[model samples]
Every structure is written in C-alpha cells, then in structure tokens.
Target: MTSTFPILTPAGVRRILLDRKEIALIDVREEDPFAQSHPLWAANFPLSKLELDAWPRIPRRDTPVVVYGEHDGVDLAPRAAQVLRALGYTSVHLLEGGLAGWIAAGGETFRDVNVASKSFGELVESKRHTPSLSAQEVQVLLDAHADAVVVDARRFDEYQTMSIPTATNVPGAELVLRVRELAPDPATRVIVNCAGRTRSIIGAQSLVNAGLPNPVAALRNGTIGWTLAGQKLDRGASRRAPADVTAINRARAQSGARDIAAKAGVRRIAYAELASLDAPGRTVYRFDVRTPDEFAAGHFPGFVSAPGGQLVQETDHNAPVRGARIVLADDDGVRADMSASWLAQMGWEVWVVDPVDAGLRSETGTVGHPAPEAEAVATITPGTLAGWLNDPKENDVAVLDVTASANYVKRHIPGAWFVIRAQLQQALEKIPSARRYVLTCGTSQLARFAAADLKRLTQAEVAVLEGGTQAWIEAKLPLEEGETRLAVPRSDRYRRPYEGTDNATEAMQAYLDWEFGLIAQLERDGTHFFNVV
Candidate 1:
C-alpha cells in the first residue's frame, strides 16, 4: 500500500501553492527540521500530531494532501499517508523524492517559519520602498527622548522578553486602528519593530497603507538588528498600547480603511447576508481579526480566530485554499477593513462582516477546534505507569517516546526508546520486546496518534500516556537524559545555525543576506500579487 501511493513532483506542488489552490503540501517531519529547509509555501504538519491536528488543520477530508519528510534514510510520507487514510481522508499522496527532489527540481526553498509572510514583507519593501531606520538611527531618537513612539509590533510577551528601550506594545493588527491615539500629536514619529524583519516591515507599511499622517518607519531589522548594532535592550518591560482611541480618530481610521479596501474591490457584507454568499462550489473561510483575548471574550460562532496581523503574515497557513472567499469579522471596522485590503490585493475575494449584530456567539478557550477522538487507543496516566515501573516481575511495558528529538534529548522516561510516530512499523524491530507497548510525547496528542499505529503493527497491547511527558514531570518522577538509547536517528530535527545564543556574526549576516534576496525570487516567480496603496 505504501509503494502504490501516487506521487507529486516538486514543480507540481510549487505551482499549486503559487496558484493558491486548495491543495495542502505538508512537510511530515518535526517543526525544527522543517524550519531548516523546505519549499517556500509548504506547511509543516508533523506526523507526531497528525490525528489531533489533521481534522482541524485540514477540515475537508477530500482536500488534496501531499506529505513528505527528511530523505536522509528516513522517509515518513508513506506512513503519514496510512494515518491520513485511516482518518477517512479520501485523497492523500506523497511528494516524490521528498526534500531532495524539491531541491533538485530548482524550487525555491526558505528557512524559518512563516516563509510566505517574510517573502511578502520583502516584496512590500521592494515595491513600495517602505520607509525604515537603522538600529543606530532609532537608538539616536530614543536617546534624545525626541517626539517619537517606538511601537513593538510583536506580541506583548515577546515585547516583555526583550525590546528596544521605551517601545510601546501595539501589535501589528492594532497599529493602524489605534496609532492616532498612541501618538495624538501628528508630529510624533512612530517606529515599528518585531523580533525580526517581517512584522516590522508589515507593521510600518500597514500605517503607510492606511494613510497615517505621522512619520512612520520600521526599525531596520528589528531586535536582531538592534542587538547586532551593539544597542542595549530592555527586559521585562510592561508597556502597553493606549487604553482607548479617541472617537474622532476611530472614525477617521474606519473611513480611511473603507477607501483603501474599496480600492481592492473588497465588499462590505451584512451579518445576515453571509448565508446567501455561501454559494455552491465555493469554500467560505470566516475569520475574526481581533486580539486573541478579545476574540475569547466574545465572538460569533463558525469563525476561526485569526488576528489580522497574523492572518496577512501567514495567509497560506490560515487559508490554504488560495482562491477561496474570505470573510473577516471585527467589532470595530478598522481591523477587518485594513486586513481585508491586504487579502484582496493578494488575490482573494475578501469581505468584511459586521460583528456588532447579536448572533449565536461562543466564548471560552483560545482554540476554536475540538480535539479529535481516538476511540481505538487505550490510555494510561503518568502516575499509573510509574507504579507499573515499580513492579519487578510484571515489568513488560516497552515505551516509545515519539516527541521531537530535541525534547527527547533533554529528558524522558527511563528505558524509553525515542521514535518517530510515522516510522513505528520499522522502529518496532529496534525496541525491546514486551507484553505491552506504550507511546508518549510532550502533550500526549502525538502519543495517542502513535498508539493506533503500534496496535495495528503488533499484537501487544498498546496504550498512550494520558498527559504525556509534561504529566510525568508534574508527577515528580525521575527522568533520564541524553541519546544513550534510540530506535530512530536524530535526523528528524535540523539545528538552525542562525538561531540560538552562540550564532556567529557571519552566519547572522548571511541569514539577512538571504532574506534580502527573496524579493528577487518573487520577481522571478511573478505569482505574489502584492499591491501597496
């Protein structure tokens, strides 16, 4: 069954993503490895969390899914296909030759998460010549305590972790909507920044696109640039965006956003009109573009929570079906209006749904989707398993820790074999024989998914650790570290040279150099319709 699966070439997959069609090009390896190298638009769908995530990530069972993995003697695409099929996915296939084949076919590969967003940021800068200031220049403004407001466009937590001295926390989506309030005096210069380039560029440009009067510029390369420039960074800063925007400023932003959106041919849809627009032969994606906290406070039903800033930055991740119609909802029209403008220019048929109407609304957790049911797999808790380990003669349990290689190396249950969830069939040969096989991961979701594979491949009783390794830690059990024993190679993960504490200066510069070249790649591909107002 594995060998008989149909294959998709690298060139074919590239065209699919470039065309913005409904096909999901999935990288089945763990996230860290996928970050090292992969096609520009490919989404990481690790085999570890397939069952728990597949249903929600790829809702339509029949949506074309193409899975691939590391080609270094560890091919997981076939095994991933089996799991997808078991979950009732009608159309599933493999990427021919895997990562190597994609490289061979001359497809553009990018490192790091949110490649599409970063590439778009580069494109926006290339086309619009969005204003920017180097780390040195921004530092000068701050030192002088000039009439300038440095707005960190990253999440509040990231801002608190490390930030440019005296930057306020107005995230990307909120910038245009509340900038006037942040800098009521039009003369106050607004400088936007992120951990790196993408959000900074997008945030600064968002204000420009919205036609803000304040002088705006992105911190040349953000915190990374700031550190590299030998500037001091503030830690544990608690600055936040303005408490409220003035009424006049709100009306101006809403009015300006409407004009910008109109230029992209974006439509304004009433709450009731949403039903009529859900026509046959069209996939309608409903999204609420507000703060994660606000969305959890109160939001309409049947809509996924995608912040406006993140939705635009990771459009392919949020809406893989490129041509699908997208409807964005928000309490204030500014976020929805501003976000829809970007989506429209990106070639989506976009609309804004008024969120003021009282509809069937749900407010609870941050996540929109429910966990998938794994009825076939039995479960055991960390404490019960600890008691079983205490039994001397009845010790017949063989554990397979299917967590990421990095996590496994740090700590794991004593005598557990670290294995990839997809490679369980072959991994069975390497582990010790036992009366029962147990599976585990960071959160136990992957363990549950792997449990089904263990049951199918062997007659031994297979059970998943209920809360996984985290539960074990909380249970106060001892853990063993290092790669002393393993059923799988550590090839599933790729150590990023540009990340971590000890990165060499040249490598950081090289990373930035590569990002600088993405604009040319976009020019060569001619697919991204990045229109700047």
Candidate 2:
C-alpha cells in the first residue's frame, strides 16, 4: 500500500534549505536538550510556547513543516505533527529520525542562538557601529556651528508628552516614506533618537543601508543614556506646527499648487452623475471616512466604514480599482478633502460626497447608539453566483482565497490564490487581468474589503464568493487542496530610512542630486533589487 504520509530525510531537509523553502525545522526536545544546540534560524517554539506564539508567526499554512526531537524511545515529532494538523495545517511531516538522524547525516548545529538575545545583540552592535551625538555633543555642535539635524523617532503620544526641544517626532515606520519631507538637505548630519535604544538603532541603520549621503547616527542609547551621562533631556513636547495643517500645506505649495491641483483632477459629481455610473454588472464602492464610533452612530445605508488616513495608506488594499470611481461620504469636507488629496497623489480616481446632500438622514436622529452605515458595495448574490459557477468562463473569472494560510491549506475553492489581506496590495502583479475576480474569506467582512479594493485598484471585473468559503462548501462546490505561496509586489520592496529636521538649503540641493544619481548606480551594480520590507 502506498503511504499516505511522507517522512522527510535529512537530505530532503538539506534540499529545502538550499532552495530557501519556508520550512520550519522545529526541535521539540525539552529545554535542556534545546539549550545545547539547534539549527541556524531554527527558533525554539518550545512545546511550551507552541500554542501561544509559535503558530501565529508561521507565515504559511501549507508549508511543509518538519518536526523532530530526542530519539531514545521518545517520538515527539509524531505528536507535534498531529497537533499542527489539528490546527488545520494540512502538510505537517515528521523528520525521518529526529535530531539523531540530523547528527548522523553530518548536519551542522548552531550554538547559543535565541531570539531575544539575538535581537538585543543586533541592537547593541548597531549602536556601536553607527555614529551618534549626545545632548551635550549636540549642544557643542551647535556652539561650534556644525551642520546637523536632530529627529525624535517616537510615537505621537510620546512626542506630545515629552521630547528634545530641537527634535521633531517622525514615527519609525513613517520615517522612510516621510524622510524626503523631513530632510531636504544631504550635507547636514542626520541624528535620530528614541526614549531608549531599539528604535534609534534600527532607524539609524536604515539610513546607512539605504546609502544616504549625510552621516546618520543614533543618540547613543537614546534619551536615557544621554541623561545618565550628566546631560540634560528635553521635557515637554516641542512647540511645532501641526504636521497635517502646516507641513502638508507647505509641501503642497513646494510641489506647486497648480501642478498638484491639476494632478488631483478632482471632479465634483452630482448624485445624478454618480447614479448614472452605477450599473448592475459593475462593482462600485461607497466609503464612509469617519471614526468607527461615528460610523456606528449613524451612516448612510450601503456605506462601509473606512477611516480616511487608513483608507489612503491602504488604498490599493482597500480599493483596488485603478480607475474605479470612488464616492466618499463624510459630514465634514475637511477629512474627505484631505484623504482625497493623498489618494489622488497615489494615482486613484476619488470623489468626496456630502452625506446630507445625497438625501441621507441626519445622524442626529440617534443619541447614544450607532450602527454601521446601511450602504454596502453591491455584491454578487447567491443566485448570480450559482449561475456563474455553473458556466464559469475562463475570461471573466478570478478567485482569491482570503482565509488564513492554514485554513486555505486544509481546503479552498479550486484555482483560488491565497491572498493575505494585509499584503494584498503588494500581490497585485501576480493577479491575472483576464477575468473577473471572486474573493472568499472565513467570513464576508474581509471578503467585502478584498472585493471592493480589488475592483477599485485593478478595475477588473470582480465579485465576492457569496458567504465566502463556508458558503462555497455548503453549496458542495469543488475544493482544491494545496499550500498557498504569498505574492510579494515590487513596490513593497522600497523602504524609507531617514527622518530628521528639514535640511539646510545647500544640503537639500546636494542630497537631491546624490539621490537622483544613486538609482542609476544601483541599477548598474545589479543590486537595486534589495529592499527592507
């Protein structure tokens, strides 16, 4: 009889390693055994941490996971595989002979590698190598007339509570995207700091890796370290102009108001025009860009809640229509206008509509209780879906599996690609343009977001698999079993590394020249493909 399960040998594991497959070689031995040695990159998800943190970080569900442990009559691999399979991972496999087999096979073992220690070490090494100036040093630099810019890499709340008087808060993740906005000058020294060290280390290293012309450094050990060294720490938030109102407006002006306005290409459409564009066969999205609480308070029927900033940042993920007309509803125009401006810059077709103007009831009717807007993007109905499934055309069909990787592995709609909702935008290129796409998730909420976003970004014919995968199974549709491979987009590779005070005019001009030319150099060296994220 043919065996239903496969036991992977050390040779098989080696092949996976060479190919860089996403296989986790788990050592299920007790703490004492694990403390002796483990494979490189092999994290000890100790049987203890298994149910808690280990399962969450396993990037893919269908991944060929290999488990091993001590041999002496103790077969932990089998039990581990069973648990993983119970967790809905369909492809759990046991290492042929556990750690003993690996040793006999002459496999290498790593000593003294733990996640926490490695992370801390990386933090320390980064600080030791990167340049940094203390508060006193910064004062001295100012006294000596040296050109430098200081930036605070902390959350907005922390920045508001306390920060260096001369530093500006540019949150860590936003640093790369907003770097050019912060420092236009290349000649000025760029200094980064956080409350302690980790953020500063990572932030400073980011600039260094990005090949910034200006010298970048962390404020050694950050604010605490500086204060401990008999130096002063600036308290109370810096009195700076609001970023949204002042900085954004200034940036718009510099980019050229006429040019920006032209690029925005905003058109005010009447309710009649909006209705004219709506068709039975076409997918349309109506968004209420307001807080969730406000949306729950009262909103137009059929409108879904997607806050303005998040909607813009995740436009490609939330609304994928490249040229899909978007109608945004908000009681006030400020939030809508701001969101529309950013969306336009990112190459989206967007329109802001006043909820009251569209014959919608006033939210004032409800005092305490609120509900999600009654308006939802018109989606495919079960009858229409059944009809499509019966005669599904190759040209007008696409299927997206939005379930977690593990769930998708156990069973999913045939031909549906596993698309992580968070990474949907980056996976756009992998999606085919030939057919209408159908999105399925554990529930309909994520499916709606996926379907709406896909329709908007790709402008491809789209539909949500009614009732998601659950309904698909209930209808007895054919199911396919396989592991899902994540699609990573080219744009997702580019990461920003610097966040500092606005550079001096001379430094700004110099840096711009360097950056413009570096792209060509990177391409010539054939190393431009490297990206942080």
Candidate 3:
C-alpha cells in the first residue's frame, strides 16, 4: 500500500537548503540511532516525543517539514507526519526512502549530535588559525608556575566532574568578560578548555575576536587531549570566576563584543521588531542568554532561557529549524552580543535585542512550557498510588515509566517497568496483564499521552501519575535505582565519548579524528553557510 502524505526526495530537501528557506529536516528516531548516522542538518524529533516536543521546536504550523525514520524495520516517518498534522502543523511531509534514501542519493551523513555546530568550530579554527596549547605544554606551564591561568569553558557541572589542574570554570560566554578578573595581568597566558574541542576553540577565538589584551589559547582537544597525553585531571574542583566584574572591564567587554557582533553582521533589534519577525510564516525564537539563575530571577515575557555557551555548543538542538531568525536577550550587554556574533557567523539571521527598561523583565522563575494537551486521561496522585502499591494483590495494578531510559535507571518507582512509548504495544506483549495500569515520566505530561495510548491498546483501566516521578520523590516514597526491569531496550540517549572519565582510549582518539576531518566534510556537504569573521 502506497502512503498518502506528500513525499520529498533528498534532492528536494537539499534544494530547499540551498535556497536558504526555512525547512526542518527531522529524524523521528531515538537519539542513539539518529546519532549513528543522519543528514548534516537533520534534527532528531523521535516519534515517542513528537507530541511533547513538536510545538516548541517547530513553532510555525506551516513551516516546511520533512520527517524520516526507521528502526528495526519499523517505519516511523509516516506516523510522525500524521502526529504533526494532528498537532495543527499544516505543512508536513515524509522523506522518500528515509535515511536509506538520503544515502542512496549521495547525501552526506554525519555521526554524533550537533555535527553542524561542531563542524563550524573546526571551520573557524581552519580559517582563523585559532591559537591553542597542547595538554603537555600547558602541563609544563602549570608545573613551572608560569604566569598563566586555565579557564574551563564548559558548564560548572562539567568542570566539577573533571578539570585541568589549577583551572577555573568560566563558561564560553563569560570568557571575554571574566578573563580579566581570572588573569589580571595583561601578560598572563589564558588557557580555555571544554570536554572536547568545540567549546574550547570557540571560547578562545571569542577572546581573540574581542581583542583582549591578554595572550589567550585553547587547550588543544580539551580534557580528551589531556587524557590522551597521559595527564591527570582534577575531580570535584570548584574553582570559579569572581561574581563581580570591574566597571572598566565590563565597559571594555561590552564595546569589544558589540564590535565583533557588528563584524559578523548581527543586527541590534528593538523590542517592537519582534512582532514583525514573528509574523505568520516566519519562525522566530526568542531566548534569554544569561545564566540559568539570572534568567530565573527575571526575563522578557516571550523569551525562554538558553545559556549562551550551551546555545552555541548545541545550536541544532536549541533552534533545529535551519534558517530561522533568532533574537537573544541579556540584561548585561556582553553575553547576548557575543552569542549572537557566533550565531550570525553560523549563517543564522540573528539579532541581539536592544537593552530594555528593567521593568520589562518582570517574569520570574524558570521557563517550563507544558506540552500541548490531548484528550483528558484519568490521573492518580502520588499518595494514592503509594497506597495502592503497598498492597498490590487487591489493587491489581501495573506501573510503566515512560521517561528517558537513563533517567529511569537513576531513580523511579520501586517496581515500575521502563518502556519506550513508541514500543508500548510491543512491550505490552511482555508484561503480565493487569486490571489497572499507571503511566509516568519526568513530568506527568508525557505520561498523560502514554496513558491515552494505553487505553486504546487494551481494555484495562489506565491513569497517569499526578506529578510523575519527581512528585513521587517529593512524597518521600520508596524508590529503586539502576536498570531494574526494562520492557524495551535503552536507546534513547547516545553516549558521547567526550563525557565522563571512563571511556576507551580508542574511542576518544576516533572522536578527535572525526572532528579533525570535519572541515573537509563541511566543504563536501556545501549546505552550511558559515563564515568566520
């Protein structure tokens, strides 16, 4: 039976990309499989998370979207397209032949996530010859107590997990503004590093671009390189940049960042321009590029928080839609300008929102957009579920957790079985039948959809945990840890070689080799509109 939804060839998608139009090339498979191989610009929008993620990720209903997926002979693309249509998305199409079709058409595929931004980082280094110091050289400097400071450009949590000796955490966006405080002397050498190469290169180049007086360099290949060079990394280190920036340093940083942003062709937009950019056909993403705590304190009404450093490191995950217009906001002048400079160079039509009255940032607390609603599903409070679980014989119930597999392994209800929502029916075949079933995830939102799905698959009674696993923990309920019972394989997240202390030497070297070759890959692909200023 041939399908009814409109079909797009790999060539058609490429044409749209070349034309610089808005097109979402979505891979509707779990991240593990999608990370194995995907077209250069394809964003993973798993079928299991389609309803929960679609609205926020692809906000414009009529934006051209091409979905493709296949796992264990299960064709998920058509199903994903249908779900998009039901969510009020008017322009949804399936990629002809899916991943296989793209390969057959000679389309370039990339391994690992965020290849677009990672490759761009390599391109930036190639074009600019970004300065860097090998782990061994940096180690020599540290051993000699030279006039140098190592700034880890990753998130604080990553720094805490593993860091270079005598390194301080000053995430990428803060490098230009905070480096002065970290190394007060203009002659001090500043070394920036991350788990791997991208953030390290970008962080170092940012200072160079800002024309910082200090001599700066990235730690070549970051911690991975350190490990490869037989150097030890410090664990549980909490060194950080000072909280306060000197007025003079702040002024210099602001001027420098703005100059670089202008060089990269980033526009400074007034708040009123947001409405025009967000007009019907256009998809505009408004983001607050400050720290998470700063964003939680206050933010623009329509903007969500995306820390500037992580935003650049994970542009594909943050924006997804190629060619979408992005507006970044920050109370301080430097962060947003610095972040926008990189986005502009990445070929996005990016703008930094001009400073507004403090009164405009009145919204308090972290941004958490609830997934769009589906038909009402019955709900059970965490307390009520606890009572039922205490004596299961009479209650005759089964609990299914639909959260990420990794999260499920960390903590979950004492006896709930981990299951993939997309494989719910197949998983049902393995679980013993029960009179009643309860579903849960990180929040009850995803579980609510899963409950509705379960109701259709069986005649059994179905309900969602009122507040999901978080609420269960808050209720002081007993919890189980580790992969207790799994009805489906854990294929949700792809483990990156750059993460954690335990990884094969071979894998780390392979990851580095892959990144080393990305500049050539970018040229062969030819869709990236990157320009290094």
Candidate 4:
C-alpha cells in the first residue's frame, strides 16, 4: 500500500526553519559525507547506529522528526521511519529527495561532522528563542539594578581575557548540570552567552530542556555581536563576589537551615556525624569549595577538588550516588556551607565539614599550614616551564588544562593537555606523573580544583599554576597553537540502538503502517516528508 504523508517540498522545510518550531531534522548519512557538508540544524544519526540508543536521547516521541539522506539507493529514511515508529514515535517523516533536494531548495549547509550542530543553529532561528540582552540591555539592567544573572559560557581563560563586565564564566555544557548552583534564586533571570553563538544556543536550550524554573535566555550572538553593536564588553576580573560561590552558598544555606528544609522537604546532617561517614568501604566525596588555585595551594587530605560553582553543576557526574555522603570543605565556611546546602536539597547526605577544629579556633582562628612536604610540591614557574619544551625531565609532574575545548584548541602552554572539568576525574590517567603534578587552566580557579583532586586520589605533591596559563602568558612564556586533533571520544557518535527479536518484527510492521498512514496525516495536518521509489 502507498504511504499517505505528503512529500514536503524544500520550501516547506524552509518555512519550518524560519518558524522555529520544535522539530528535529535528522540526516541519515555516513560520517565522512556528513562531515564534508550538510544542512544547518540537521543532526546526523548514521544508518549504522540508528537502531541503537537514538530514541531515548530524543526527549519526546510526539515531537516532529524529519529524516533525510543523500540521494542514492541506500534509502535509509524509510528504514529510520520504521525504527522510530516501532519505538512509539508518532510523528516520524522523511525528507523528499534528501540532501540533494535540500541543496536544490537553497538550504544552508555546514562542514561540521555532526548534523546536530546545524539543527541546533536552526533551532535558535526558528524558536526566535529568547536571547540574553545585548550589551546595551545589560547596561540598562545594571543601571536599574535588575535581578539578572549574566553568565559567560566560555573557558575561564577567555573570561579572564575579556567578557561582559558583569558576566561570570560557567562554560556551556556545564551549565545544565550546574544551573541550580549558579542561580539558586528561582526569581533571578539567567542569561547565558559565549564568545560566539553555538555554545550559547546549546547552553540556553540545555536549561530549557532540563526544566529549570529560572527564566533562561542566550546573549544574542554573544560577545562578538555585543562588540559589533558598538557596545563595550567587560575585560579583566571584577571585584564582585564570584556568582558561582554566591549562588551555591545561598542554595546550601537554605537547604541546611531547618526552616528551609521544612520548605523544600529535605534533610541535613551535622558536621561530626558527616565525618563519621567518611570511613573506608563507603564511597564518600569530600569536596573543597574554593577557587581551583586556592584548593591547589593546599587542602585537607582526601578531598576532591570542586570549585563550589562547578561542584554544583557537576554533582551528579562527580558523585553519581544520590545517597552518597558529601563533605564540603573550604578555607572559609562561606563556599562550603553554600555547596552543602544545595547538595542537601538535591537529596544528598551533605555536611559542611570545617577543615579546622573548634578547639583550634578558640586558641587561634588561624588555619594551620599543610605539612612541609606539601609545601615542597614541585611546580613549574614561567622561567622553568620552558625547559620542559623538548628535553623535559620526567619529574613525576602531572599537567592538566581545564579550559573549554575551543579555547584549549586556540592556544595552550606546551606539554599541557585539555580535559573538560566534568571529565577530569575519569581522564586522570592522561597526565603523566614523575615528580610533583600541576594542574592548569585559563585561570587558576580550574587548576586549583584539578590539583586538589590529584591530591585526594594520590599522595603526590600537587600545585596549581600560580595564575594559571594567563599568568604564564604574562610571564612571557613561550606558547604553541595549531590544529591538534583531540584524542577524546565523541559521546554523541557512540550510540547503541535497542535490539530484540520482536524488535524487527514490530519495527517493520510499524514502519509500513506509519508510512501508509503518514500520507493521510500530511493532508490533514499539512506536514511534509520526502518521497522516493
């Protein structure tokens, strides 16, 4: 029997692009062909891996799914439609004439390996997705003292070099995981931006997808657009309290206090009782809620390094067990208390474990220094860092770069390697250690976190770059930059489709039935799909 869905002309898809409706454009093509070029906003789910775990990643079954492929006998669209329908997707459809038709219809394409990137761009234009205010809008908000949080979703280094004056760095992919920590006030409007559009768009959408209560928007076009509009962007760090710390503390305090617990319907633990849970056999996470640099400078043994803000963002990733006990430690109680509060609300057993004892406080409120050996941790000064360039001695030094991928690609100090903060713990082996280990980022904040983590996991002496790579640069250290292929695995490319004996049977039947019924729906709903013999 013939299918009922109408063949969507290129014009129809174009209109959808302009309208910004919540639809997914899927390109079923091999990786190499897709990397060469594909329409903007289209995501490639190669035919090979389509049957794997593609469906779960797609949040909604009823949401419109448009499928296409290069013009060839491969005819993967129909097969994809079948699998989607069998999996209970109600609105799967094919693109007419596939990519060839899209090009003929004047659609824009990108050279990126993933089609999802292009579709993401299309999502921005179509949804008329609310973008963060321009630099002018920010200026107005500043003048008015409006309750808005401007987040610089770039690498810490980029933020250090230049950013929206009032903006704080929170890296894009990290935001969804960290949103609750970054903006505890449900009333605060959260605005995310990057140096350019991609990360901003992805970051804002991630919050929306996660169903955060806060109103989230992207800074339109980002810093580039802001500067192009003749508006000034913030350069250099501000003296204001770090937004991450502030938000984290607020959330923690609220969660820890009995009154707030009564409101959020959660519980909190005492400091001593929490310490009791730290014994062996239990997977305990002791988090140091200080700037990465400060954490690197020195910290309590066995504490995982997490800047309070990033700790909140990546709590689940770092501490997957919702029931795991978390001990929050910081030089001061401010950040620890704050992070503890949020963790409590998230249903984690949390405590603000003070590094110093109460008796010590009575005698002298001064914190004790780490052991002298800890003080002797080997670190690379700008002057000595150059020696490691070619004939560097293996000093058991571990080097890590915690900056965003894009910035790391732009330029990085020699012998330094990149690791997304979230993935640092998992990828710890990448760093070679012979002497003392040093962690670096665009700023000392990330380095501090990494150094602390190294100390917790190993007995090695650890230090953070004094000011991170930025300080190294200021010291006039030699730098290197060029295309260096990241050996990291692509999470998106790796997927496994659901498989079962009843799967193909049910899938094939659902496929044919959907194809036949789609034509009728097209006439009634005015939706479109591709047609091929």
**How many clashes (backbone N, Cα, C below 3 Å) per candidate?**
0, 27, 0, 39
Ranked by TM-score from best down, the candidates are: 3, 1, 2, 4
Q: Return the lDDT, model 1, position 298.
A: 79
lDDT of candidates 1 onward, in order: 0.81, 0.54, 0.92, 0.55
Model 1 per-residue lDDT tens digits across residues 1-533: 56767888877777776666767788888777788888766788777677767776676677788888864486878877988898888778788888888888877677877777788788778788999999999988888999999999887877887888989988888988888987989899999998778889988988987889999999988877887898888888898987688889988888878888898788888887888876754567889899988888778877878989889877867876545788999888899998898888777889998656544455545764656666667889888888888789659988899988889999999988999876776688888789988889998877876787678788888898888999999999989999967897775675443334455767667667878988777676555666655
**How many Å off is the CA of 423 in candidate 3?**
1.3
lDDT value, candidate 1, whole model: 0.81
- Of the candidates numbered 1 and 2, which has the greater TM-score value? 1
lDDT of candidate 1 at residue 215, scale 0 to 100: 96
Candidate 4: how large is its RMSD? 18.8
lDDT of 2 by residue, 1-533 (tens): 11345689988877765553445667665444564655533445444224333333352456566777753365656655655675666676777767778768776653332322223324334334667666677767756867776677666666665565577776553343345455667778888877555466555654554345677877765655554555555556654322443465344332332232234564455544567656533345567765566677777765677765456434433443223456676654444554454455433456766335634633432223121221155566545665665684644566777665667878987667777553456456786654577777775556775565566677677767667788877878677886644453211111111123322434434432433343333233231112211
Which candidate leads the pack in TM-score?
A: 3
lDDT of 4 by residue, 1-533 (tens): 01643356667766764453445677766545565666645666664345433542343456567887752355667766766676677777778778788777766555533222323333333444545566577667767878888877655876766677678777553454455665778889888876555456556655654456788887765665566566666667542324444554444433333332233333344545555765543446666666666655666655556775455544433453223466776554444554454445444556665446534222222233221111233456655555544444644454667665556767878666666443344456655544666667776654654464567777666667777788888988767674243423322232211111122434334332332332333233222221110
Clashing residue pairs in candidate 1 are none
Clashing pairs in 3: none
In model 2, which runs have C-alpha deviations exceeding 4 angstroms?
A: 1-14, 26-40, 43-56, 68-78, 94-149, 152-169, 179-188, 194-202, 205-215, 220-533
What TM-score would each prediction reach against the true structure?
0.88, 0.36, 0.97, 0.35
Residue-level lDDT tens digits of model 3 in 373-424: 8679999999989988897564688899999998999999988999999889
Better of 3 and 4 by lDDT: 3
Residue 383, model 2: lDDT of 51
